[model samples]
Target: METTQPSGTTKRRVELRITRPTLTWFARPTVTIDGVGHPAQWGTGTWAVPDEGGTRIGVYLYNRVWRFGTATRTVTAADVSLVYRSGPLPVGAGRLDAA
Candidate 1:
């Protein structure tokens, strides 16, 4: 939605909820809006280190977080800006962008 500003400029408001566990780390990710990078959501580490091994080798062990629901969001009002709603890939892995 948008509204006319007192200065005759346009003002827009957008509400986004990143409830996905996969998106809660390294701060929020960035997406392009009008050729600009915008932080919209976040994610946490997907792979937990394995306590079985000593050190380096133990890090190989990884796991996926469980999910309770799924969702998606977008705001392409002639701006092609997508805020990316929920399930936004795991952090620390090659999950960002394309997996």
Candidate 2:
């Protein structure tokens, strides 16, 4: 990602799209030098993403774990719009403003 610069701030802006997916299963940390997947429990971690064998990844910092894998999830402003459009849980009739 390029740092924002005054000269081309608007032109080179990255449309960062973030989609808050459903809370996934608690992932157990694992490691595989070769092509294998192992499950780590409670307090273990390795560099691996959700998928892609070995590419994209998410670092579980608070949990104190870091992983590396190939599974890049792109989020966009539009996506956020869609998610909120449905409104917060407890199921509403879908509104821009909900009390």
Candidate topping TM-score: 1
Q: For residue 35, what is the lDDT in candidate 2? A: 39
lDDT of 1 by residue, 8-97 (tens): 233443333233444443333343323333444343222222223221111110134332122222233332112223344443322211
Against the unseen true structure, what C-alpha lDDT does each candidate score? 0.29, 0.25
Residue-level lDDT tens digits of model 2 in 62-93: 12343322222232322221111222222222
What is the Cα root-mean-square deviation between model 1 and the actual structure? 17.6
**Candidate 2 — which residues are off by over 4 angstroms?**
1-10, 24-63, 68-99
